[model samples]
Target chain A: MLGDIKTVAQGTFDRYFKMKELYVILILCILNIAALSRYDVLTLNMGKEFMIDGALAILTVVALITSMAVIFEKSRELREKTAHFIITKPYGRSSYIWGKFIGISFLAIFNMAILTAGALIVFKLTSYENVMANNLATEFIYAALLITAEAIVLTALGLFFSMFLSDTITALMVLVFFILGHSFYILEKMSSESSKIFGWVSDILPNLHNLDLKSAITDNITITQDVLGYGLLYAVLYAVAFVAASSMIFSRKDIS
Target chain B: MYAIETHNLYKTFGWFLSKRKVHALNNLELKVPENVIYGFLGPNGAGKTTTIKILLGLVIPSKGHSKIFGIDTHDPDTRNHVGFLPENPKFYPYLTASDFLDFCGKIIHMDAMERSKRKDELLEKVGLTHAANQKMEGFSRGMLQRMGIAQALISDPDLIILDEPITGLDPMGRADIKRILLELREEGKTIFFSSHILSDVERMCDMVGIINHGQLIEHGSLDELRSDIGVNIHTTGVASNALMEGEKLCDYITLKNGEAIFTLTNKSDKDTVMKFISDNGGSVIRSVKLQEELEAFFLRRIQNDEKAREEEVN
Candidate 1:
């Protein structure tokens, strides 16, 4: 089963890497981050805050794009029946779901790393003294890690929804989930004032806010070890739950 | 034990909005023995592909069960000894032919050494060696079909199931697939395939099953399914008067250049026809039993099944 998962993961990663459109999007994203980091309007005094904000925002977009790429590819696999080649092999359906999730998550991480690296380079190249005095490198790394957690959750969510829904519907659901995940506090607030259903929804929705450390970076507030550890734990739990649900749904699915 | 077996397998697809159900398979009982080429024959939407999918555990049956090599198909290990090629197979277009096979090998858990060896052997066998490194996106339909076959054999499975394996192939490609299937059978592999090419099935299958309306209309050896319809007797030197007597014994007779041809719908009439021709001083030339072709037999069975269903409905 491990071998099957590895094969599918490697295959999925290779397939996504070979898509010229994906590369084009990635390149555009890197350039966008580069330009945003070196924007002249943000003076050197505010350079760290501005660069980190823009980079994290761009990273979110990259994560969303990577998630959508996964959804679209899985959708095409089912629509074109290419998945038959893999699903009919001597491997469990759970392995397929895990493989896809892992593969696309790796791509998401790669994209995030490249964008983060590009943003950091531009920040250092444009504002050398600011970097030395403030020591924003660690903060940027923390911000990237938080975004990576968010990307992992989104990728798993995308894979889960794509298993049972059409491409358009899956994308819409993932997008809605991402929005709701980040605004879970709104749902929590609504629950206190309005209805218990909102409370239930908030509980079920992943609290992506926990993983949002951009403010921490921009404000130069040190993110405690406890907070970072909890955030990572939350992301892992949410991602695992989504993947487990996906596996259960996919195991009984008719690949016809 | 049968290489493939299904007991009262039933499946139905339901439209969620309309609440209308399409019965794809109804009490489908099939038994395919090991080490033989079994041809599954059916018209479009006759449940051939559905049955194959069920056997591969790609689709779940609404009722009943199927087993491969005596193990339930729902078990993933059941596929350890089986390889399948779907109809109009689609692959990861970005992958080269060689890479695609290697991926397939890994799915079946073949180690790197075994995968490498099998990859080369299958590519050469399928005549795709030249395009080993070329992306499958650039392949023609025939090349893709060959690639499909190669992947199906990458595991060196005990049972190989293919749906419409020869649909997009030229005559030579078809012949090559036929040779491969035959060779696999010789090596103790059971092959179950469905194809619209009845002539190819007729040439390769040791046993066949014809299905329609989600039911098995015919299942048996080719010879058993294609019973001798009648016999034709050719004779020479039969006097015109004797020819008339021979015609009375036979279903019909034709004469040309002092030669007589007798066609009998009944096999028993052949001996009588021959004896009468001998008594009439006519020399027998040859006698040939006329048997139905698989295509004709398949059509006749399906038509009869449809007629029966109509009568039942009426």
Candidate 2:
């Protein structure tokens, strides 16, 4: 069973990298970096703030697109019966679901790492002041980690949606979840006086806003290790729940 | 123990929509002994594929149960000894043939060394060694079918279940698959396959089950079914309708070139027909029961089914 999981995860990750969409998303990330560099130059040294924001924006968009593509590709495989080769083997359905979850999560982290390097390169070549090089590097790295953590959570949600829903609807729902999750704080505040259901909804949805480290760079606030650790734990927990739900549904699916 | 067994296996689909059900497999009872090729024959939508799916645990039976090697199919371990090739197999298009086989080996928990060795052997057996490095996206249908067979054998499973394994192959391709299946049978592997190519089934299958309308219509050893078709008496020396009229047991008579061929209506008439032919100055040229060809039997079964269905409809 462990071997089965490793094979599926490795196979899925390898296949994900081979996709043409990954390269397209990489090129788009590079173009976004170029645009950010141009904006930094036009502002005549804006002090590393917009550059971090630009980097996070690029990471979020690329992560969401790639995650959706990966999940949809897998969903299509199941519907098209290409999965017959794997599902008919000795492995359990849970292994297949977990393999896909881990595989796409790996891709999510890898994609963010590549774009983080690109964003760092962009910031290095561009002019910025009011912050030391080490400080900027540290801040940029934490921001990348936060973005990746959130992306991991969203990827799990996308995979869960893909199991029972069509690709278009799954993509749309994941997008909606991302947007709503980012505004979870605002929903919590507005619903404080409204109904108890709204409060539950806010708590149930992933608090993606908590993982956003961009404001730390802009507001000159230091993000402690404890806060980052908490955010990572939250992401991990949500991802686990979503994957468990997906595996439960997939294990019993007729798939005919 | 039987290699494959099903007790009153039943499957129904689309039960929620319009309150109608499509009975794919209805009260199917099957038993296949070990180390023999069992050919499953049926027309389109005759539940052959559905039965295979149930055995593979792809679809659960609505009622009854199936077992592989005496182990319930619901257990994942039961599939460890079974290899299945679905009809018109669809594999991941991006992986090369070797990589795909490696994945299959991994699915069955084979170690790297054993996987590599088994992969090479199966690739050779399926005539896919030359295209071992070629991606499946460019493969022709025949090549994909061959690759499907190779992947199915990657685990070296004891029980092989194939659904329409020879659908889209040239004569040479068909011959290659037939050879592989026979060789596997020789190795004491249990091989069960469904095919529209009755000639291949006739030549390769040790036992066969004919299914119609989601029911087993006829099943037994090939020779047993063949021998049930009755006897034909070919006589020389005189061509006459007198043999048919005199024998009172001959159902039909055909005369050509100073020879008469009589189809006896009953097995009991064989001795009487022979005696009468000898007594009437006719020499029995060849007298033997004609074995029913698979094609003929299949067509007759299907025609009978259609007639019965029509009568009920009327």
Candidate topping TM-score:
1
TM-score of chain A of 2: 0.88
Candidate 2, overall lDDT?
Answer: 0.82
Instruction: Please write out the lDDT profile of model 1 over residues B1-314, one tens digit for every residue.
Output: 99999999999998556578889999999999999999999999999999999998888999998999999988888988888888886788888998888888888777899999999999988888999999999998888888988888887889999999998789987988898889888989999999999999999999999989898888999988896888878889887776666677878897766668888885456677778988888898888788889989888888889999999999
Docking outcome class, model 2:
medium
RMSD of each: 3.7, 4.2
lDDT of 2 by residue, B1-314 (tens): 99999998888987556577899998998999999999999999999989998898888888998999999998878888888788877788899999999888887878899999999999998888999999999998878888877887877889999989999889877888898899999989999999999999999999999888788888889887764667777888643646656556577767767778878755556777777777777887886776778899889878988899899999
Clashing pairs in 1: none
Q: What lDDT score goes with residue A255 in model 2?
A: 65
Off by over 4 Å in 1: A37-39, A42-48, A131-133, A187-203, B15-18, B232-286
- Share of true Cα-Cα contacts across chains kept by each model: 0.90, 0.75
- Alpha-carbon runs more than 4 Å astray in model 2: A40-48, A129-134, A190-200, B15-18, B226-288, B306-314
Question: Candidate 2, A225: how far from true, in Å?
Answer: 2.3
